[model samples]
Target: MSGRAENMIQLIDVSKEYKMADSCRVALQHINLTISEGEYIGILGLNQSGKSTLARLLNGLLKPTTGQVLINGMATDSPQEIRQIRQLLGMVFQNPDNQLICPVVEEEIAFGPENLGLPPEEVNKRVDWALELVGMQEMRYHAPHLLSGGQKQKVALASVLAMQPRYLVLDEPTSMLDPLSRREILEHLCRINQENHITIILISHHPEDLLDAKRLILLHEGSIYMQGTPKEVFKDMEKLKAIGLKRPGLYQLIQQVEEEGYRIDDNIKTIPQLVEMICRI
Candidate 1:
């Protein structure tokens, strides 16, 4: 945890509710959180646990019913500051099909910068840079619809990266992809966080996806159920199961090996680590 880092996003006593003719449903309840700049934070929850709602609030796509959401010290509720807030924070959704607007990949990547009224030369530069960043430079002129699921997702991510946002909020960006694609997207995001110093707020249901995050936040029934380092949070199997979540496959395997009288270290998170530990035994 980087305690010395400054806060980039803050939620203070925030709550969100949707009103219906018959009843009002609360999506979030009195939540308070602070996300520092350059931090990789993963949000974990089951469906309808307010994960998507929280992402929208962070980027000002949805307003909080109560309290406040502040991005870089600017209030999300302020209409005048909304544009600036959005420019500083980029959001990618679960469906790449919905996010891909332009027919061509390069055009889609340039859309955000073009909207900002950047010069043509600047827009072209950004498009090229974003394509390279996502390892999609060869697909620049390709049609988005003709690409694979992972490629489309990479194009969508390139579009967001083109804007050069200081913070990126992803809501289940890998949910619709194949297993290999999911791993590729996660690896790219990890690189973006480490090399670019961009703050990442990733919402995911996969236990393995949360392992690399500096902090993991678990939401249950519209409230924060747990918050801690990945190891600290996932080690509590009983609590996670009660909240409808599961431990990572690696963790479960390690536990089973320990039960078989093998002195495996409980903290091993990767296959290489496990193999190295077993060799020492």
Candidate 2:
């Protein structure tokens, strides 16, 4: 939980550019990053900040225009390794509907392993395990369309988890949900990363969603502007404000209380923790 496993996703001098009839656009520029196995990281950026482009580049959905993307030393651009790379690195999108293709929940969870040519018995085991992992075993027979937004997202996550990927990259996954649903999804992600030891690269614009991340990578206009722990990055209110991101509500409150001559632990995350600290004072 403190350090990471050996395998890594390396991006070296990577850039992505789009070409139209008469002009070109750069989504990412000379980006370099390394994601180690079992590490939970957050990628933060505003809209059009190349967060989605970066996520797609991880699983070989998009090739970098300039440099290299290597998954455990296998180049993502290689036709032979792209399939394996994708299998090792699963992706979840902003909309659950976009990823949940199968009609039933169990089938959706089984789809990845089934396509991997796993044995029927193995596939069934994976399906059951994934459903339980996401706490969706009771809804295994439910239709995807009938489920709530949060349930649908859980099914989508279970579908990816069924494949047993070494790394999971999610792009604005909780953006479409209500606050409670969003919190639920983020909590599930924390549990998934901690319990299963799967490396998680969570891409989102919301600072609140990334509070559980072990490391934070802040992207501004497609380049990494800052990288640190959530405590380190969120404490710089002026810098975050300049980048169009606000400090999380809880952190803001902590700062305000501290400014009023109260001491709060740096690890305080919830309102109850702050309340307890105040009561102690």
- The parts of candidate 1 lying over 4 Å away from their true place are 1-7, 254-269
Off-target runs (Cα >4 Å) in candidate 2 are: 1-6, 260-263
Q: Could you give candidate 1's per-residue lDDT for residues 1-281 as a string of tens digits? A: 22222347889899999899999999999999999889999999999999999999998989999998888888899999899999999999999999998889999998999999999999999998889878999999999999999999999999999999999999999999998999889989989999999999999988787777989999999999999988678768899989778888777767667777986654566778987887888
My TM-score estimates for the predictions, one after another, are 0.92, 0.94
Output the TM-score of candidate 2. Answer: 0.94
RMSD of 2: 3.1
Q: Per-residue lDDT of 1-281 in model 2, one digit per residue for the tens? A: 22222499889899999889999999999998998898999999888999999999999989999998888888888999898898899999999988888889999898889999999999999999898888899999999999999999999999999999999999999999999989888888888898999999999998889988989999999899989988788878989889788878888888789889887776676788889889988
Q: Residue 85 in model 1: shift from native, Å? A: 0.7
Clashes of 2: 0
lDDT of each: 0.89, 0.90
Query: In candidate 1, which residue pairs clash?
Result: none
For candidate 1, the per-residue lDDT at 205 reads: 81
